[model samples]
Target: MFAQALRDILQPLPPKCDIPQDEQLQEAMNTLEVIVSLLLKEQFDTWRYEALDGILLTVAQRRDADTAFFGGDCILITDQTVSPIEVEVTLGGGGAGLVRVCCRVGEKQDGKLMRHSYDKEHRYRTLIWQERDPHHELEWMYFVERMYDENGR
Candidate 1:
């Protein structure tokens, strides 16, 4: 169910004619809130989660009049963990046509900055997640474990 929900949320937006880009970006931000709620329910003793709202900016470089940038972070918290994995989302930047989602572990894990992009045409594609993975498993958990292992936890 989690995997399916992630897939649905990450699905590409409709064409600009069918749905305005601003509306599409807003819908994506709303869906991210839902996903964060789901993540909160999956907490265990070793780790918990929190969502920090990102800033909405309307700058001259943006192309759409109604489009304001939206973004946020999902932080994974753990004991003895000074640096947590931050899963971030960005809508409307220089590349206003694509919604960018990235997971940054920390300076220690600089080599593993996972980046995913959602556009209007193609179905969602991610670099690390596989369809055959367990439905209840989230991609972020993999990074959390890696962070722990690398830190000798």
Candidate 2:
């Protein structure tokens, strides 16, 4: 059911010149709704409403607004409401066929980053994490464990 919905939402559309700009905007809006709905199911406390403008601005970056694709970063507050998980979304040119959503979890100070991206060609999601100090990777692991533990409490 979820897969079908995603497929429908991301289905290719007619060329930008073929469709009206308003219709293109509507299509982008619909895609945004689905993305937000999926994100809400996660453990984030809340999404920052002000960040939405950034997404629109990204879409408007191109000279031709109708053909402009979306690319922007938004923050999802952690369950404890002390930190933020950044989600960066980018769509392929002309607004359909390919999409990339990257989520960064953990702290910059600790030198840990988690990236999650969906590959349209492969039809799969990939999760990759990096740590600066390989020798002390366990510290980063414990940090995440403690964060979840605290959130659970």
Best by TM-score: 2
lDDT string for model 2 (1-153, tens) is 222333333344443422223554455655653554344434343333312211221122222322223322222223212222333333344424324444433334555333222233112211122212325332211111111121112
lDDT of 2: 0.31
TM-score of each prediction: 0.25, 0.26
Per-residue C-alpha lDDT of model 1 across residues 1-153, encoded as one tens digit per residue: 322332233344332222233554445545544544334344433224434232121111222322222212222332222222334433432323324333433223344423222222112222122232435433344232112121112
List candidate 2 stretches off by more than 4 Å: 1-21, 45-59, 62-88, 91-99, 102-153
Task: Write down the lDDT that model 1 would get.
Answer: 0.32
RMSD of each: 16.1, 14.8
